[model samples]
Target chain A: MPRQRPPAIRIALCLAALAAGLLPWWNAREMAKSAFPGFEVTAPSAGESGEPAFFKKTVVNPFSPHKKSHSASLVRMEDGRMFAAWYAGSGECAPDVAVYLASTDAAGNWQAPRAIFNREKAMADLGRNVISVGNALLLADGNRLGLLFVTVAAGRWSGSSMNIAWSDDAGMTWSRAQNLTMNPLANLSALPRNPASPLAGGGWAVPVYEEFLGKFPEVLWLLPRGGGYDFAVSRVAGGVSVMQAALVPLSRTDAVCLMRDFRPAQFMSISSTADAGRTWTPPQATELPNKDSGICGARLPDGSILAAYNDRSTGKRENLRLAVSGDGGKTWKRVATLEEEPGFEFSYPSMVCDPDGTVRMLYSARQTQIVYVEFNTAWLKEQEVLQ
Target chain B: MSTLTVFLLVVWFFQRVLPVRGLLGLGVSTAAGAAFVFIPWLGFWIKSLAPNASIPMVGLLLAAILGRACNKSVFRPADWKAAWIFGAAASLMLYPSALGLGAFDTYSLGWPWLFHSVSIALFAGVGVASAVLLWLGNRFGYLLLLAGLGYLAGFQESTNFWDYVLDPLFGAVSLVALIAMAWRSRNPRPANPRGTTAP
Candidate 1:
């Protein structure tokens, strides 16, 4: 027979196991608390009426430079200036494809778009022949602006890899590119479409998706590491085939993602993460109709979620609509129509709420130009009344 | 021709020259290399049919040369058993998790800290195993060493470690071999019951 250990040793071993189990749980809870703080949702008052006002501007000319241009992203700089980026070339994934950047002055006049990065520059910097480059996302981290994009290595999208270039001078100059190595296969097909949402714990969560062999949606946490940012990836565990997720935080530890489903679900898929996007619940279909196109969202000042998407299931790429959720995306009310016209394509929407409660939305108009629009709660309320 | 194809052909020719010791091996190796290189349709067909299927030229060459010199097969029964075990274990671990049927996403282990640690441990384990096999006079040790070296040198276009170790073709072959072995073992042919009574 084996000898029995002392009570103290047994107690120690039990305590060790208990600690090992509870420590990660405690850490995750604390991280979630710091990352997302709960916000009170104030419902919009009824019967309010006023003359709604908004400003609209075109950021780029699609016909002069490139035949096709899309996937536009916008970021507000530290200097109170707005910046936007998109890819343009003969077509998507073409060798001549390049990323273009534009900025608006303090007077809100849009600047001419210029080529920021192209295939030749990327190839030269990486010391390899880059087949194509696209999916340009601009993220503002304090004083630095981080540009994330994808490069096809072996002349195929399945061989795609991600690269990052930072600009400290606010889009004036950029540093050389560095490989963002997440997958061993170098096949991180997911690209960040919307700007990253900042966490209270000195990090930001960016939504990305993978569509190589299958559709796998994931959240990438960009934390400050040394002088630059490093990524910690967590899969969004939805059994559905979803991609290009738009994340909306509901509380300090909880957030919801609206994803684009590739399959003919005809509805925007929804998934929630309670631990600051470390993991997510399985995705399910939502009430909002989607046409297998990219959508974007941002939290309003009054703690409401605002989403912009093409609001039809089986129609032409027309009628871009805005929806508002007061109960943290549990229920949404279609508040306004931004664009509605036949024989036109309006998709890939990105939204941002300014300090003065102004909602700035930038989206591609017919794959020809980047359209920027500004409005507020009053405008949404007025439109709601009109409907 | 791609640089990789050219490089592989040159290595194959050099390996053949050592064992055959004549112009015949050189000519044959050269012809094979030329076919793989100059024929665009052949390359495209191979890629389409079996995406990651490139012959393990170094391993085959080493096996052939050693078999010729020693007048015996380079791969022993024990070597085949090892290959089967490696293949089965890899497929079991990779396929299900890759398909998202499992709880843990094993592909995420490709990230740096975990990736580096696992790769280093695998290399060390293979080193010890190969050393033991070589000490026991098995040429399969050379094959394992060559594979490890090829992975480290980025011999293939892929950066994935799994692609270096086993592709779909290798996995299927090993699985079939294991099944056949199991069947033979379980249903052994009856011995000549009437000893020496048959014609």
Candidate 2:
């Protein structure tokens, strides 16, 4: 027979195991508290134009001959100019698909879209034949701008990998593309669908999701380390399938993420990270409806949250609605209907608030054109009243 | 023919020139590899049905073919156990995180220092374990060393350490072998009575 340990030793070993189990929980809790020490909710003022009322709409890629142009992301440069990026090609996931960029001048005139990167160039640079390219995301890291996109190598979504290029002089000229060494196999298929949320520390929290084999979301925090940036990934807890997270910074350290539900629910999933995106609570469903399409969220100047999403839970991709949340994304009131046609597919909205309190939203009107919309809080309030 | 098919055909021709007992085995294995690569009917069907083939898998199949041509086991029982262990461990780490079932994202560790350290430690541990097994008259150590060399030489299309070690094919094979072993252990054959075994 095997000899039994002493009662005292067994008790000590059990205690050690219990402590080890509780260590992560305690660390996460402490980190959350330290990150968001005094979290509070501030409501937006009623029917006040914090800035001049401006409402402008235009077609970003009006003359592109490509069969499809979608997945647009908008970024505001330091010089008050706005640049929008989207992938255009023969169709979705085509080998010829490339990331294109266009910018708005000071007079609000949209420039012609130019192909910045494509599969041919990327394949030559990486020394591997890239199957396709999609999911073009523009991130602003201080004076420097970064372009993040996905390259499918094995002609399948599961074989996708992330590639990035940086432009120091805004979106004029970009550096050579480099593959993100996230895995040895580089089989981690992730695509960024939203702009980077500025973290309290010297970094940005960019929302990315894995689309192959698994459909879920994770936050890539690009922290400034050594002389450049190093990425740290934080997995969002809960939810069987979620993707394309749009992050909204509630406070300096606290933030909420809105994700598109890929499961059968067709409802937008929400998760909150209080420790500057180090850890997050499990995602739960929001009251807002989603049609398994991309959504965009931005923090307004008046401390209001602006969200653009498809209004219907299940149907054709129609009725793109814009809503404002005063209480940190807990609840939202529909302010304006961006698109309400029954047959038209209008989705993948990306928004950025300008210094003049103008909210610029760029979305795909159909698969053919990129639609741009600029509105102010006063315009949103008037639309709310009309609704 | 596709590049994969051409490569396998060349391997088959080379093996056929050698003095081997089962030339048909080489032809059969080459036919299977060719079927998977050039035969669109079967290749597309398998890709659509399973869709998790990686570069490492092709390497393993090629190794098996070469081993057969040389009249030796590429992966002995212990080597199969090692592959099984690797496959099962990778499946547990990757599938759950891929499915969004956990908080700790194993994929995140792919690029960090933690991943490099873990990879190195795993390599060392497998080396030590293989050495012990070899001292006890097991050939798994040699196969493990071969795998380590293959990884170091960057044989797989993917640069991920996990990719070189395991994929869905190995995982499924490991699971099946484990189950079969358990079943056999549960119903062990009766010992021969006083050395009177059947010829």
Candidate 3:
């Protein structure tokens, strides 16, 4: 018979894992209570302007010469601009395809569509590859914008590599694009950092989910060093993928990122990184069950973390809801349904809380149309938390 | 780059590029070095194939490498069979694109032979080799031709070989199958003098 492993070793491992999982929760609740301070929503939203907050029928290619769109990422420029970037073409992997960007003023009115990146130029230099951008951020550093996304020059989606481009003056003027990595298929990206991330020796690091040869999803570091991930005993709050990772700084060695595990039933997944993003606490499930749609996360004024995603487990992004995490990310209570019924199918929630602490969100329904929701932290607190 | 650098580049490329990577290239290089170390195959091949063999063999080597890499390590050794099938399917996936109905890129053929032939052969061969290997198994010595065929995967610089390398959630499926295989391997059926039992 194969030698049975020692019982003590097994017990030790189990206890260690249990302790590791619980420690973050105990700490996060305290941090959330302190940081979130409180939250609410705006009474009259941009939707009041002839358009409702929810556009449940999004076209696959709303502006394409033909019409086929897929894969999107949303970000808030430091100037308080809301930009939604997505791939618009005949198909997800077609050549005529190009990455497009659209934005809304702080008031929530969307600008017209425009191309920001293309494959023709990418391949002319990087060899014939496909380039797609995701999660662009306007860092305080040099007021420089950071663009993170995947590129596939040699094959298809799997050949994806992370690449970036930047704009100095907000989203107006751009910078030459650069390759961030050679690893293909890096997905669902976000940059989160506290005072001590390893890349910054304790700063911000881009956290993107990777599901290559590996089973569970893990976030990798994208700054300080342009290499692989830094591993440790702890992990982000949960085991999830296409994770909507948002960073909230509470203290040194502690931060909360609102995450959604890819589980159809277990909606809310939040992870914490103690020694920066190098290691994370296993994510815990919340009352919110994911509607099988992607979510987006951001920080608010009073220190609360804002997360938007399909609230239900079925149907469309229709139930896209906003909730605040008062206790770091340990617990979440719903704020409001940015989209109500007859307006369901509203999904792929992307959110950003302005400097004044006001909240804004972008989403699409039926994959045919796009919509934006405007709210205030105060209005949200009045609404019920989904729990 | 010099001939030596290109050869060295080939070595590193094979070792690093492919997703379902096998040490076949490294192993082959070692074997060749060993031939020179003793048997005289490397020196003989060098004298025989020389400069002309470099380009064609490089392309074949790419296809074989990709073909072999896509074999088992790419997916999980257990589901190497499925991945082989998928890869073969992908290779044959040449549909009506920018090039009409023809396989390989007509664009490159208009440009360079080294670029064109290598690109088409590797892409087409990998899909064929992977499918043939899995459905057929190691029986026909197809795997023997793997490293030789892998170089073909990247004949066109723009080719997306990562599908064979990383794939999407296929890795997770492979992980499950591997765990099952390992578990099965560990828990073997005990022999009974009395013979058969329930599965």
Candidate 4:
């Protein structure tokens, strides 16, 4: 009962349809041509291999800071200058919270940390209603200092997203913020805790986590593209219980991820990748205890791993300890106790190894101050013998 | 791209708010879109609802609604129904795993086409679906084609292919409408004595 459309029009439509279908496939094929050339891992070289150096100090803001501070991260710049960042406010997820940054001067004195970003700045830059800001991580990309932090828009931690900003003049001034579209649905729940590790091609493998629907660890790859960077995310493992991964690249083709355990197991989980981060073994529990708190790790010049985490099985973040692993994180031996007071909290430890074999550590002290600790393999060797 | 989506969505909202009778209403809609961007909290609320939704989806819906409000039929009811069914299916295939119901994340497969074969398969599936829609003479097929081009141009903040094709809000609406349509089909209104249904 209906007159048919012309066959010529249908033919034209089909040809156009074929082109449309091929366009995305063509784009995808072109994109796949530039596969990641593996991580450009730089294990600490044996520069001054046997140097016996040990240093410890607490870098705090001279002015009156916020009531609470947590998630401290440290990065060594190209000029060998050390910079630190952490978020502080009335409480976690509080509207008053702001990300703060500090750098050590030539005289080795830590300058007062100044507020680098906050909810108001986020609201203004993002043109959205931001509820709070938290979990700031500092990354060194050549001479540029990059800060990745979390901004909550509507709800609690579940309603959060990640934003990145760069400072070219060593944290004196920062560029405008750009949101990382980690999720398309309201861009919810992507948080960065640990600083990134150097990849093979002058790129960075930043460790971040998701906490909204499920808790899991993911790696955000910032591969150099022309003069800027291309972003990609690879899931370390799939689960609802492990998150806040600390990625430590052991070689160009090998890395281990340390994850915070949110399950009843209460032990830190470990996953390894033999081909950069393209694929990972499902996380298995390590002997190290983790009570849903943050952890960090770095590779020493001796091919050893030094990890800092809240070492407890009873689910209290009152004790922070250092552990050394020679078997690629399969086992760990406690070397030093950095903080131990049952009534107080000292958690969220972030560690990084300097080129000259100096291990710098940072963590929240009593949830009120950011504490910095430095040591060397000489100190670690001594602690190992003592243990 | 985000700013563009915000502008388009705001224009659609303005049409609803003003609801003037003809093509003249679009002038009012443009004025409202320009003013709302500077109005601060209003823009944020809209973005907070669906921040990273596909641009073509929003743009197409806006065009359809405006055409009707201006007494110009750009899309028939069948075109919208087809789009709803397509979008709802895509969402179901993604959100369950993305929300952590399974061990694998469907969302991560959208990062690029190299690491996962699933992405290529999904892309090819979309291509086939586009061809089928075009063959059926549905205008929603054009939307699908535009989404593919937009994806190639990186028209959205997200590089994931799924983000350019489907979003949670659109998926939710499509799913609800499909369910209602199914329910109504199962229980048709009784025919009037004059062989017409009551209004």
Candidate 1: list runs displaced more than 4 Å.
Answer: A1-55, A154-156, A184-188, A238-240, B1-80, B99-104, B112-199
RMSD after Cα superposition, model 4: 3.2
Q: List DockQ, one per candidate, in order.
A: 0.06, 0.13, 0.03, 0.46
Task: Score chain B of candidate 4 by TM-score.
Answer: 0.83
Candidate 4 lDDT, tens digit per residue, A283-331? 9999998888889888887777888888875447988888989899999
Across residues B1-199, which tens digit of lDDT does each residue of candidate 2 receive?
1245344645555555555446566766566556555654444333222333444345555666667677776656665665566556666766566556677666554332323333334444444554544444444434444444554555544333344445555666667877787788899979888878563
lDDT of 3 by residue, B94-173 (tens): 21111122222222211112132234443344334444443433222233233223323322222233222222233343
Q: Who is ahead in DockQ, 1 or 3?
A: 1
- Model 2 misplacement above 4 A: A1-50, A106-108, A154-159, A169-173, A181-188, A237-240, A313-315, B1-80, B110-173, B176-199
Q: Per-residue CA lDDT of candidate 2, range A1-387, in tens?
A: 123457675444444333322232332332332332222323333435566666788899878899999999888776667788999999878988999999878886888888888888877665545778888888776667888888777656666777788999867798887766443233457678887776555557778877665577877656565677655455775345788888887776678888888777777878887775657877788888886888989877777778889887435578789888888788888888888877789989988765445788889987788999988887887789989
In model 1, how large is the Cα lDDT of residue A355?
Answer: 45
B159, model 3: CA deviation in Å?
23
**Candidate 3 interface RMSD (Å):** 22.1
DockQ of 1: 0.06
List, residue by residue over B83-174, the lDDT tens digit for candidate 4.
88988898898887666555456776676544645565677777778777777777787788777777777777677778888888678878
Select the stronger candidate by lDDT from 3 and 4: 4
Per-model fnat list: 0.02, 0.17, 0.02, 0.47
Clashes of each: 2, 4, 78, 4
Q: Which pairs of residues have clashing backbones in candidate 4?
A: A39-A200, A40-A199, A40-A200, A160-A189
Tell me the docking grade of candidate 3: incorrect
lDDT of 3 by residue, A90-180 (tens): 6655666666667665665666777766676555433323444222332333334554445544345434454556666555655665554
